[model samples]
Target: MRGRGHRAGRAARKRRQKQESVVQSVSLCHELQYVRLMKFLHQRGFTSTLLQPALFTDTGRGLQAVKSIKPGQLLISLPESCLLTTSTVLDSYLGHYIKSWKPRPSPLLALCVFLVCERHLGEASDWFPYIDVLPAAYTCPAYFTDDVVAVLPSGARRRASEQREAVRELHSLNQNFFRSLQPLLSQPVDEVLTCEALRWAWCSVNTRSVFMSHPSNDSLSGQDVYALAPFLDLLNHRPDVQVKASFNDVTRCYEIRSVSGTLRYQQAFINYGSHDTQRLMLEYGFVAPCNPNSVVYVDADLLCDVLRGDRSLDQKIKFLKENNFLHNLTVSSEGAGWRLMTALRLLSLPQTLYHLWKAVLLGQVLCEEREEWSVQTAKTLCQRLLQDSHTALDKITNLLRQCDQPVREQLDVVESLRQEERCILGSCLELLEGPPRQPDELLSCAPDVDAVS
Candidate 1:
């Protein structure tokens, strides 16, 4: 028994060592690739030394400040030759053949084709250095396996489905367009535009491409509005940071300046707009733990579900549709908006008072009596939403507990989303369940309401 135990321990140690070696090899390869990419950019006029690659224990690869960067300092300036724009793709060797197709492809589709063709050329392609460093697979929910996708919350699942459909449509277009060129081409269509190849290229473009507005005098107006700005695209997103990026016609380079200062060794980030956690996850394949714009969408269907037993449901639905209040219901850090509360109040009104409610909704009159019912109805709806959110969160939490070690990281992202949602719903519930005040008290306190009335 002692001999067997000793053998087993030795085997385990060997396996761990092998795994560590593999990980180290991959890290080393990535470091080399980063160096090559940086060198490539430097040769093309990226001279700023403020940014350097910094690996985090948890966040993987991100750009860090080598020296303290002051606000308004230009951190990167890549010449037009470095930008992988639609024009560049359209002007490439592959683009020469793509233009012969019956109908010209959109800039995005053309870029995807260019990516696949360039990849097929392997080392011979001019863009090989840039292409080699692009991520092999994306983390976006759109790339999640079927089982993982099935577990996504309804909102995320819907968005993922939409993205998948878009990819499918683009793939179909590629197929049809490539089939037409197969007769003239020496290579098989599959080898040139395989689904897997197209998908990789599609995701690379989706996640890495930056929007660049063309100059008014540029002839490429209304073409592809996005470009792949190599090193600049490597900057991770933080909601708080602001960056001023633009194409400098005078210098003939793309410039990115930090509007906010960065401390030495701290990761510098760019604002990807005011995206919520869900939007970030769907589009960028990662969620920001501290996204200030994080919100929980309370769709009209959920609202309708909450008011399922209300009388004259059809009438309420019609009114909601007519008033265009059946959508855009959301809860954020500020809690539920007034529109949601007003919509719930409208639903709670009796059939006889529908006209009065409509009048109030249209700002024709002030119905003080229904104000209490509105507040009560809003509270009830919030309570239901809060309960449902908690249930969803519990399911996700339980799944996390039982999930396999390999998939736990991905599940953690879903868990973060659910937790944010729960926080939003909880906040809304708190606001709705605040101490009930008399309508007169509310009116007296609101000088604006008194004046409006």
Candidate 2:
């Protein structure tokens, strides 16, 4: 009996060792400090780690330049070993479950799963140093409260709903895939991979990941083109700065060339590309002042209502949609956008002049009467938008003055978005009501679409 007990003890030790190995292989994240992160990167082949985390009043946390850097300087050449990408996921213990599951998970889902799982692993996670610095919460619509979401403009309302629904649906759809990872995880997959957990992971990937092309794979539901880089993701976005960022094939490092170099002690910023104010607010959770790409998206129902009096509206709307000209209607800093003008001209056509729709679309000048109708219709739309903008702005002001609530920050973001949108509408009206001059290609031979202010 004593010999039998000894044998059992030996067996127990073997199982414990196996569990430790499995845990170590897939450990996630713990609270890693800046010093440790810098140290971690230095050891992993990063030579020029000459930056530190800094705080800015305007942009919150961003990387600060410790030394003066010149134009065309290679600001950051991050090694690929630091990237946590889908390839890393596919090679882990969870990879086999991902492969043999009845339905394949999206490449995005795979990345989110890895991040959440690793984060749950705490100190055991190999990338704990990097994950420790990631924001505990995000400001994207997915993180917005019900009260905050209730106040979004007509244009952004649909998109915000879809963003939240996407997270929820993704969580609901992938229950089996989550369950398949039970053998590798310390707890039940549901506990670690909750909907809230997935949401946090999804936002991290959406807001922080970099663009890195991946090898073609039929297994992923969509393209797997994102990679999470550690120090590289620290750079905040600045619209005016010019930079060249890419992965260097020979060096196997993700490099950034700062065309507009960051000065010493200044916060460094990167360009997220021609994103408008609303886009910045919805996807990344912020807004920019005087964004050139910013525009007010016209509501389709409002567009239809404005043209309802015309008898041929039904046929005109059909032609516009069929030709793919109905979507993307907008008003911008330059006044009525091309797409909006194009659709309006078609909608303004008299029933007898239906054949001239193509001519109108192609920038041909219709009769003075038809041109006047289109101009009047545009003016009406802009007027309605201006009223809506004013109402929202005033409501926001009153809410802020009336209370100092926690939703103040959310209200402020929406305020900036609204203000920029109002600017675009105001310009549209000036263009519509401006002096009669040479008609531009956008309109059916009417006044030039120029913003006076």
Candidate 3:
């Protein structure tokens, strides 16, 4: 009977705690201007998964959750969250200045100021100028914010609460972090403010990594939804945004050419084109060719043109000799220009079959510079290959053998490129081979030399 009563008491306590959490959450939501923010986000096509409130504020007043939003959107955490208690304390001049200055507010910049000012400016003087805010967001002394606890699944919430408890148990954790920075803060107030703002801004980036791994769950905490919705959609940084000058008038907003990081802007502009080309050459995904002649994926003609126009021939040759043909080439003096010849010979595969593949792979064969290598090119190549896989394979094999050292090295590349798991190249290769094995039969095969070696 005592045990039964104890169980009943525990259950009642849990119910009370949950009810209290909800009430506290709703109240804090108003305090943080979440409702206003949510309304704004809704207008922008964001859906909230309001995470639990207690997880937000250690003492029970904050929020956490995952939010669903479109890519490359921007989210603005309002000015109200900072001004809640002492908004009336602003100077008339300052207030007027803020009202008149129509700098399109940056969320990253604003959040950085808020985190730092929360520690310094008391009551109403916390609003910092946006111009002073941009540097920290761009670079950093570093700042940190953790994932709001609401992004966790329901089963994990109890554990998340436990983790929060553990964090609190180490009461000196936050104090320690701040205490170590006392020397830095003793500098001029402006310097201190700038550094602290940068510090926390850096922290926010790190905190994002923690939440980034969270899987989508059906149910979410209010905080989780709120935080994520703003971040991934509206607050995401794009090179284009850097290119854009924030302005009150749309006409004046075109001053992005003067902005720093113009190369990133250039890339963004190219990416935005109707070509929608993958431009695999620009992607950092692959290392540059080791053997120029052996690799057809690179546009040798364009490279030659670029090199010939600006750089020394010797330097160009040296770059190709060092980077392309082979990093560890054992060139024999007896061979003379053999390495160069070999590199050029290897360029044949790309000139033919691989050329067609690169087009479809990059989605840009139809592009003006390489129109002959697009889908239409693939159709042409496929038609020729269709005459007989065996015949096509024989030609490829003969070409591979005669194509010099650089071309012969690509035998491994062709084999690896045929991996079913890697890319569509594998499926095409499979067709070149015979019928594919059934899943069960494929699974039953013994470990082959190809896989192990």
Better of 1 and 2 by TM-score: 2
How much does candidate 2 score in TM-score? 0.85
Model 3 accuracy (lDDT, Cα): 0.27
Number of clashes found in candidate 3: 36
TM-score computed on alpha carbons, candidate 1? 0.81
After superposing all C-alphas onto the true structure, candidate 3 shows an RMSD in angstroms of 23.1
Cα miss at 406, model 2 (Å)?
Answer: 6.7
Estimate the TM-score of every prediction.
Answer: 0.81, 0.85, 0.22
lDDT by residue for model 1 over 158-216, one digit each (tens)?
88888877887778766777776565445898777877778777877777887776533
lDDT agreement of model 1 with the native: 0.65
lDDT of each: 0.65, 0.72, 0.27
Residue ranges of candidate 3 with Cα displaced over 4 Å:
1-52, 55-107, 122-187, 202-352, 358-453
Pairs of colliding residues, candidate 2: 27-125, 28-118, 28-125, 29-122
Candidates 2 and 3 compared by TM-score, better number = 2
* Candidate order, TM-score descending: 2, 1, 3
